[model samples]
Target: MSTVEPTATKRFSFMDILKAPLLIAIALIIALLLLGEYLSPGFASGQQILRLLIVAALMGIVAAGQNLVILGGREGIDLSVGGVVSLAAIIAGNLMGGENSGIVLAILGCLAAGAIVGAINGIGVTLLRIPPLVMTLGMLGVLQGLLVVIRNGIPSGRAAPGLSQFVTQPVFLGLPGIIWLWIVIGLAMAFLLGRTMLGYRIYAIGSNEQAAFMAGMPVKTTRILLFVLSGMFAAIAGICLLGYTGSSFANVGEQYMLPSIIAVVFGGTALSGGKGGYTGTMAGATLLTVLQSILTTVNIDESGRQMVFGATLLLLMLFYGRGKALRA
Candidate 1:
């Protein structure tokens, strides 16, 4: 009877600790929304809320990929995601040429491009023993340079009409089709991370790569695959951005890089790796979106917004960074 009581207490304590971050994110989201409502009339109205969710969905999509790489450990990070996103959007735009007929091809091309870039990063990290950060940072520069050469300072084409409509137009339950897309993708990613052997291996490797390798896990391959997947997700996000903006521009993805990282980290995912999931990332994304809306409603200028954003990220990093250091 005493043993059983201790076991139950341990289990309950573990569950509470596991749920704490997600609960905090949810609470923050609600608090921000309430604040928005107080500061601006109609701030919490259905339409405005839906818009915020839509934006959050975009960030969540990108963060989903970042989550995977971070989960792969070895200081895995994809700084090239922004460049891949920009390249994918530009390619998709040019390929689609404002026509629905080529949308499929455009999408495939963007994904392929992303995969190739990711593969390069993987090779550098795994085969050449290059650091992940350096490899990805170099890739980012290369991709940006290539994009500039390709576009020659002038980008062309527009988003396909159908694609644009799908993203912006209302669909089921008055939500935009893009929101539905995000939900579907999020569910799939959740299932992949939570219910699959691959996910198990990823966590194992992230927890301790040398130990995982000794235990016969395919550490190198898994890390490479994670990078590839991250690139693909970034490409998908770029495609969505194209739909949202209805045009492509150089460095269009510049805005997403930090936000995606922030979303992942804010969701309790460890930058050192192996300690978080997409669920928390989703909540974090929503929280950031709502916070942005609140700031905008309060008429915060661009410089003020950037200052607040940086300060917030710094604080979160300190909070989580300490935990990571302590654990180490």
Candidate 2:
């Protein structure tokens, strides 16, 4: 009998880690589409899917920011994200006021404002020793108050005609400009998280703060950068909203708060932090947008839609909470 050589033992590859969330997202999208079609024969359409993609791109941008902060580890998170988005959208719109002439300055001012807010978050958590949850939650209140004072309960200004056109316009292969922007941001963020020393420090700090500090990492600077990154991304999401809606409303960013968290969770990013990437986040955003689109196509009322949204999030918690449980 010929002795059979022992088969080489297979080890888990990096590709396998990346594959799970993408597969899950695709499977869910397919299932949702079929279910939607069954419920409403007209529900599944290319146009509808494209629309969802645009929305997902916007949320994905926001989630990318949150992912950065959370990945810093140390139990970091940004509860103020909705407020930041809402406030930034209004501020950016007011600055631009649909004026082509003012667009450049407006963009600069909005980015600056976002950076300030992010810095505040970082300061509170790092210097004051405030927990991230409490600090960001406080920021949400402060920002909302600021937005309320700025608008005085009414959203003002239309997005610039040029900006609006660009947002909704198609680029190469007929994809929306927002989608292309997401691609650029995703590539940049992936590089920052994977290629740079900062990226290594983020994961290192997140995995174990004390260990990271011992290794000579600038923990404070890294933490601050994470919060600032969150603000920047949130502002970017707001910019997309401004373009998508053409006008700002007091509640323009109201729905995004929980959805942002849900997208990150759905992307397989643990709430407690330490492991995830923009790749999973992009998929998560797509899944969320598709879910919302499917519901709209089926003619779900506003209240019902909100109910479904909450329920879907709850289900995600149930399935994705395992990492949290394990960490605990």
RMSD of each: 4.2, 5.8
Give the candidate number with the greatest lDDT. Answer: 1
Residue pairs in collision within model 1 = none
- Stretches of candidate 1 off by over 4 Å are 1-18, 315-321, 324-328
Which lDDT tens digits does candidate 2 get at residues 29-147? 78887888788775667776677778888889889888988888777888888888887788778888889776676678777888899999999899888999999999998998888
The 10-residue segment with the lowest total lDDT in model 1: 4-13
List TM-score per model, in order: 0.91, 0.89
Candidate 1 residue lDDT tens string, 262-311: 88887888888877777778888898888777777787789998788678
Off by over 4 Å in 2: 1-17, 153-155, 300-304, 323-328
The clash tally of candidate 1 reads 0
> Candidate 2: minimum summed lDDT over ten consecutive residues — where?
4-13
* Candidate lDDT (C-alpha), each: 0.83, 0.79
Clash count of each predicted structure: 0, 2
